[model samples]
Target: MEMSSIVLRMSPTLITNVRIFDGLSVVSDCGYILIEFGNIQQISKFPLPTAPGWNIVDGSNSTLIPGLIDAHVHVYQDLKFIETAIQYGVTTVLDMHNESEWFKKMKLVADEKNDVADIQSAGLAATVKNGWPSAILRMTAAADATLETRISGWPDITDNETADQYVATNKAAGASFIKLMQEDGCALSLPFPTRPIPTPPLEVQKAVVDAAHRNNMLAVAHALTNDSVLQMLHAGVDGITHSSVEPINESVISAFKDTNAFIIPTFAVHASSSGEDRHTRQRLAADLADTREKENFLGCLHIMQAGYSIQNSYEQITILKEAGVDILCGTDSSEHLVGTRAGASVLHELWLYVNRCGFTPIEALASATSKIAERFKMKDRGIIEAGRKADLVLVKGNPTESIDSLNDIIGVWRNGERVVWE
Candidate 1:
């Protein structure tokens, strides 16, 4: 049970006779991988000679993939969230927005503990006086005083000066990227203080994007409607965090192509919003024993208006993928959100990609692995290669053929250390 003992036993580990998905594509039908000092030492089709003290894992009839990355998440201050995510083979989570102080604390935990998934955070999203998450939070947790205080402290960015200051402050506080909020709450059924929630003006949004670039950070936007998506693209942000729920259009495709940006889609959250994929959520959470956690997964936001549907989100994703737009995997999963469980939602998201969107199973896997790492610029971990971090997932069947096979996880390793799933 000792951490040092676990690390000592796992290092110099050999996984033999496995089907390997190297993130981009299937590399070997049957092969071996050597792990040493928390990194992949060698991988090949030929057999490797065993060494003294090596822990050999028989991987016959299994598929070995790079550890999954949940490209969109909100770690907030929950150590358990990161811990739970790794149990499901999510080795990394990109925290889209969180309080800076809380993220720093969580980052320290991730840095020190191999049992938890690593995190990259966009500390605090850019905001206006009465913008995005504030409205949503008010609707969901209006009675929580701490939440109100946190919202009160968010910067009221009105122009270039404030935008520059916000970016600089966030970057200095350890944000890996910048997130812009552009929701007007029109697509959702939630009652807001204002009908069309006050969004940042186009000029302010452009200024935030420019400031983010100046600070050498990628700027991704949160938008749920076509007009909001178009506005963010025009402002030159690098990615859209969520696909619009209002259906795909030629203009949306053109705007994405024009900006050469990527999209996270976050179909898991979209499904929750429309209450269209309850059965899928139920299926995924079937094994959970905790009543609250099970209900959390089963819950739906049911926030989308009558005309808006998750099908539209799926169609938007399909068209965007067909247009050759990079689709990174994200779930927008957070403790506060209904219909999302930290690590489990990543599976739900990938399932939707292959089942609902037109992605092949391999493509869906890549979206959560290589594609996310590529778009987010994380060079150390997505692909299976020599000298890369030994963050990996071994499933019982070929997930390359059946996305659901991923649910049958045999083992998970983070930094060459085996995760002791609870």
Candidate 2:
């Protein structure tokens, strides 16, 4: 069939007889959804009357769900990253940290194109001199002068004054949230100039969080150890972008409960860091014919310390879930991040949640959908309610029962327009 023939335009479209997973749970065993003018006009368990001009998709033996959300990604100027994401049913990605101008261009692409995943960026994370990602990047990507220049331009947040300025600048640059860097480079095996990287002080982190709150933006932090997690929670941030590499402990659980913060748990990246999950990545990359893309998916970082393991990350997620702390799905997938591909890694992340962490397929699905929207305050696109944005995915089987069924994507719609995959 010609791609144009499959494309659903701005006119009304009806997908009927599909099992509906409305972000939270299975809402209907079989149902119909009506999309009009970029929004879900209506949804019903029974049939809906159709008109001649309406585009109708007979979703027999299929499942329709809210488009998946990748809660932690780094979409730094790669348009193809966003384009490839939508093809896999990831309709939205929360960019953890990106250069402001690059994010501006990326946002324009998402705003103008229905074929790309929508993005919410943190623009530039709160950083200090020679801290976090910069130290890691210096080791991994030191050859790239352009990246080094961009790193140099990142804000050197020192005290309350610099912290407030950093938040204001990012918010003005269209940052939906504030990303705080709490890494001290202790968990990684990389040989840094300093054994422990220069992380911002707790008081400075609190200032950034307070500034974000005053601007009505959420503050999410990156921490890889139990101590760092506790510090961020004490700083009063809204969430942790990555799970602690260390084992879960009571202090961590209590701190999370005290702050009521959610965790994104970018397990895909953790697997890469620890050199675990290579077999899973190999399975996920089996269909790729492109040499570079396949290698990117297969590559492992092997940067984590000897004692650190992805199993610890899994146990942390299990404990956090049991403690009533919310878990949001994120992969930390980026153009340069080894062992992760944008969009495709979300499937691996959810699969690990179900198969490794003892989560039911439905719970894994919710981590990527409604739970992300709820934690991120994105009100429009996570559920199959009337008047919500019609970011929907159609798969061959019920992913609610089998998490791996997400790989069989039949169709994806962003803003009520079907993506014309090439």
Candidate 3:
């Protein structure tokens, strides 16, 4: 058995006096939790019956909830981002895109109890030749002769054959799901600074989604406009990674309601890129201590000042929510990405769901936890209950009353082990 498993089998960790949010609903009667063997053994109104040698934690005036999960993140090979995530109460991150070459190395330490958030990646997203991310790559890649080579390195899926090959390669690389890029780099009616790039044709996108389904994997599309979203929906994608900024009319809402697909929205991403949500920006600036983080935050603001704005993104999000479409939380946070800090941005996304999209704190919390777990088909870690993974966050004050209380994170535990944030 793993060392962490052995440790858990020997000593149970018991926490008392915490207000519990078990991912589905708040537990009004519970104040104690017993965790052992990396799972929640029991939750009770009073101290649970326990054997000798169990560890005890006092959680006076605090709220205990499932550890936050970011449904959309682009993970790098470096482990620092995962460490930062754990420190800020994000115990799980679903990487929307990453290089396949990094998968083996990433998987090695993914579940290690070394204060790192566990990661599940869509190893290298499916892209067309000279596509949406190519321009992004050109801008970010080194200005050497190798820049063209780097851009050329991206997968080029032009037809069903290539799409099949791409899926096979990613699956061999241990991709948890397939990510299809449907972005044209324009914000609805807005234009890109460079010539707009193309997304995969509808047929190719459909083929990839079909292949992913055949292999028992989900196909998640990264789309940001009405047309792109509709195309993906027709192609039968399981999820839309970004909320479209295109005007959300009754027809569009109806289409979403008709489908079982969910949306991650990444609203904080649009807000950060557009320099909107001054409150969120100011709050994030106030919390960041690292110079790198501050510089990145400022850099994203500068980019947003230059980028096209996504009009009425909040309204669209609210429309989707009201239409009973599943809305998941994601920050699109990355080290190179400006406007978002790795671990901190997830909380910003939650805040946007509550303050901007009119989500109740409970509903907003569910977006990041249980809803995401269910949508992604990730088995039991999103909620706090018996027989579930003991990934949890403890914060002072009740976040259900004021979402800002999430910032006051007092402790984080992943798989029943306390993360040493200090």
For model 3, state the Cα shift of residue 412 in Å.
0.6
TM match of model 3 to true structure: 0.93
Q: Mark the regions of model 2 whose C-alpha exceeds 4 Å error after superposition.
A: 1-9
Tens digits of per-residue lDDT, candidate 1, 1-422, equal 25456556554989999999999999999999999878899999999999887889999999999999998899999998999899899999999889999999999888778989999999999988878888988888638779978988887899999999999999999999999999889999998989899988899999999999988899999998899999999999999999888877889999999899999988878888898788988888999999999998899888899998889889999988999999999999987588999889999999999998889999999999999888888889999999899999999999999999988999999999888865
Candidate 2, number of clashes = 0
Flag clash pairs in model 2.
none
TM-score of 2: 0.97
* CA lDDT scores, all candidates in order: 0.91, 0.91, 0.81
Clashes of 1: 0
lDDT of 3 by residue, 234-278 (tens): 889988998876667666687787877899888667766676665
Better of 1 and 3 by TM-score: 1
Residue-level lDDT for 242 in candidate 2 = 94
TM-score of each: 0.97, 0.97, 0.93
In candidate 1, stretches whose alpha carbon ends up further than 4 angstroms from where it belongs are 1-10
